[model samples]
Target: MEHRVSLITVGARDVETLAAFYEALGWTRVDSPDGVIAFDLLGQSLGIYPLAALADEIGVPESDLGHGAMALSHNVREKADVAPLLDRAQAAGGRLLKPAQDVFWGGHHGYFADPEGHIWEVAWNPFSALGPRGEFQWNGVG
Candidate 1:
């Protein structure tokens, strides 16, 4: 089996709605077939699909979608960029969870929830440098 992830599918209650939120964040969504939308990231793709359809395809109930236990993160290039990113998220229908602040690890971070309650963390870690394509080579979120 491969050791890296090539895609990430987010089960959204409303596929189009959630997709728009990401689009508002300046993410260019790639064309996908019916019932799914995709956004190409630095080294992977972010796919958005209807929650019910995804659950049915997996042969599980919608409750199987892990809620609070997991979070998606986007690491920025500069510490000053954190607040604006969080603001952009909030302006795009995401609920502000934790306002951007200095973390104990000397980094700055914030949290927000999409319209469907999917948690996303926006952080700036000086320790983990982002390449030109926004790829983070670090092992941890910090």
Candidate 2:
């Protein structure tokens, strides 16, 4: 088993709606016909599949699995962008969990939960480096 995650597939109750939500956040679907929509996140892939179908494909029962204990994070270049992105998330059917604020770690960040209860953190760290794709390069600072 490799100690790396190549993909993160989210089981969405409404695939098309969820896809549109992420697309509004600047993610493009990778061309595919299986109805599995995907977005390239840095060098990794984030996929969205129908909930029941995903459970069937994985041979798992569709129950309250509590797999959303973790959150996905998006880091930005300027601290000023955090509030606007949080607002966008809210406008796209996501629930705001936290308002953008300065963290004890010295960064500005906030949280939102998608329609399917997937938590996401949008942050802006002054000491971090951003790639062309808006992905972060850790700067080893608090």
Candidate 3:
């Protein structure tokens, strides 16, 4: 397998509502099949699907499909862009989990929870400068 993610799918209680929340965040939807909503990113796509259906497909009970201990991160090119994006997420019906501030690692960052309760980190890492098209690498864009 290659070291790349083709898609990141999140199960939402209400797929349409969750999809709209992403749309509110300035993500335009691509043409996808009926059961899913997808937004294409630089090299991958974010997918939203029905929570119950996802649980069934995974052979798990819906109750066991709660939010996991993981977060999705969005890296920005400028530290100044951190707070505003958090605010934007809040205004779009998400919850602000943390206010942007200087990190011990010499970066600025914050967190927010989308409508489906998926946590997301918005960070600007000076050590990992993004590529020309906003692709992220752990130690700066090669």
Candidate 4:
């Protein structure tokens, strides 16, 4: 199996709200009427679909799901950008899980949960290298 993730579809209670949140983050929604909205993220795609409908389409019972204890992270260019990015997340109806602060590993980071309880981390590491898409490449420095 390949070790690459090409798509990530998040089940949202309200597709419009979820779409709006991401749109506010500068993601443009591709036009689709299949009840699934997609956003292009660099080379990958992030999709939002209605929860129950998505489960039905996948042939899974919605009640059989477990808690979504996973988190998606976004890395920024500088440590000073952490707090402001976090503010944007909060302003977009996400709840603050952790205020931006220094981590034990010598980086600044924080967490926030989207309206649907999907956790997202915003972090800044001085020793990390970032690609043009703003993703971080950990070089084992800080």
| Best model per TM-score | 3
Candidate 1, residues 23-56, lDDT tens digits: the string is: 9999998876777799988778999988899889
Report backbone clashes per prediction: 0, 0, 0, 0
lDDT of each: 0.89, 0.86, 0.93, 0.85
Over 4 Å off in model 4, which ranges?
A: 140-142
Q: State the TM-score for model 1.
A: 0.92
For residues 46-132, what per-residue lDDT tens digits would candidate 2 score against the true structure? 999889888888787877544657999988788999999999999988999999999998899999998888999999887786877
Model 4, span 58-135: residue lDDT tens: 898986554477898888888899999889989988899999999998889999988888899998876786876665
> Higher-lDDT candidate among 1 and 4?
1
Q: Compute the lDDT of residue 72 as modeled in candidate 2.
A: 91
Q: What TM-score goes with each of the models?
A: 0.92, 0.86, 0.96, 0.90
Clashes of 2: 0
Which pairs in model 2 have colliding backbones?
none
lDDT of the structure predicted as candidate 4: 0.85
- RMSD in order of candidates: 2.3, 2.5, 1.0, 2.3
lDDT of 3 at 49: 86
The lowest-lDDT stretch of 10 consecutive residues in candidate 3 is 29-38
* Count of backbone collisions in candidate 1: 0
By TM-score, the better pick of 1 and 2 is 1
